[model samples]
Target: LLQERQLIYDFMYKHKKTYSVGKICKYLKVSRNSYYHWKSVKLAKKKDSRRTVLVNEIKRIFKNSRQTYGSPRIQAELEKLGYKISRAYVARLIKAENIRFKPKKRFVNTTYSKHDYKIEKNTLDRQFKVEQLGKVWVSDITYIRVNDKWIYLTTMIDLADRQVVGWSLSKDMTYENTVLKAWNTARKRRQIIH
Candidate 1:
């Protein structure tokens, strides 16, 4: 393929400090014009990678913020995470991605003020031991890349059984697929005699 020469040219460029460019081009069957054009493409790819990372990070943080964060807040969060970005730059990135964030409003607590919602105590206390098979089930979700697609894998394991009781996969990391489905399956498989 014609792109093969371009790849070889890139290989040479990566090692240009140690290898001779002329010999590499000759050996790889890439012409000088082809190498030069490929070089431009490589440079563009480098820039594109950085932009891609920035855009993805912006999207993640924006999502984690419940889509309520705009460019200013997103830029601030990125800065906190050690990324040097400006609000204008964030705005431009969002625009380029055709992303729209909700305008931030003042926080309002909608929970009943008089009712006491009891927080469950951590009875496990970092202990993994369980005497009953259906007692303790631990669940976690992870993202995996399959070619160009991202897959979220959720697995639940019974501590006493020491086996995966249930599992679910989805394109995006959402609780409906990961938590709900996995939980239902785990409950059925474990067969806790209520």
Candidate 2:
């Protein structure tokens, strides 16, 4: 029992990232039945530690502020009280405590693809090359599936060496947002052009 508990702790300490019960069992070289039994035993034996107390206090402050205090702010506040804690520790505590700050949930589309603004013709026209640097550029938007959520990423690439010049990420996929990213990337790279 002690060995199994130590194995579970070691596995979690080493992995850091989330793991499934099956993964835990596989990593610890134990059967699923044994892993679950040990997990329940360990959970039952668990007691509130000093870290838990500090985290609870942090959560109280976060909640009292209406969930506006993120990790950095919370860490700063704790430091003011003479608590020597790292931002990473605060972030992990927040996640473990399931304390979430209110995130900006409004999805605003700033892209005006249907507007009357002049559209620049595709200068590269699939000829993705340049004799000199920054002559041709290509950009695209892609979405990543993180858990059950979708994260949108827009990136501009220089055709000269297929290098990423700029990138932006958001929870919303807007045409204007993508175009602006590409334009900004080109503007920044203007000095690099021949």
Candidate 3:
């Protein structure tokens, strides 16, 4: 990502009359700190990487904080070490070094069970027995994680046989993708209607 910033800066430099660093940075979502960092890196080609020292300091502070400190807290620790640094720079360092902390699980309720819509009563009356194979089918929906994204799964199972009659997997849980498809497939397969 930083290398792309350099390439953009080089282009902006050649077209100085048409573009400024601020405009380029805004357009490319590149921070001014990164621009200055690239500049310092270029000017100090004769010397060793300056950020290597800062990176090491950041690592020490981060480790001392039990890896729970974000950029703001890390910057405070750096200040104690006589290094005046920006939190954004600290964030860049942490991102570049792949420093991370495990986040606690957060529960997000996705159900709308208490809404004002008309809800059906328990017609089955908690009874699981069904005389016919295709007469009574129960369905449920759930979401699965796939590469940081959620995909929904809906399954319809015959209560009498306790076997899955039909299933549908989709990226969303809308009616078209969720219970509708599964119900349609099960109905067609069983050739039965309620």
Q: What is the C-alpha RMSD of each candidate to the true structure, in Å?
A: 14.4, 18.9, 17.6
Across 73-173, the per-residue lDDT of candidate 1 in tens digits comes to 89999999899988999999999899987675566664565767887789788899888888888888876867557798899988997999988988876
Q: Which ten residues in a row have the lowest lDDT in candidate 1?
A: 104-113
TM of each candidate vs. truth: 0.43, 0.34, 0.49
Off by over 4 Å in 2: 1-123, 189-194
Which prediction has more favorable TM-score, 1 or 2? 1
Candidate 3, residues 1-194, lDDT tens digits: the string is: 65766787677667757877788778878777877776777668734466888889888887776666888888888889898789898899899999995553487897768789988889889899998988889999987877568899999999988989888999987999999999988988888887
Off by over 4 Å in 1: 1-7, 18-29, 106-194
Model 2 error, position 94 (Å): 34
Best by TM-score: 3
Residue pairs with backbone atoms closer than 3 Å in model 2 (clashes): 111-176
Q: Would you list the clashing residue pairs of candidate 1?
A: none
Give me candidate 3's TM-score against the actual structure.
0.49
Which window of 10 residues has the lowest lDDT sum in candidate 3? 41-50
| Residue 64 Cα positional deviation in candidate 2, in Å, after optimal superposition | 34
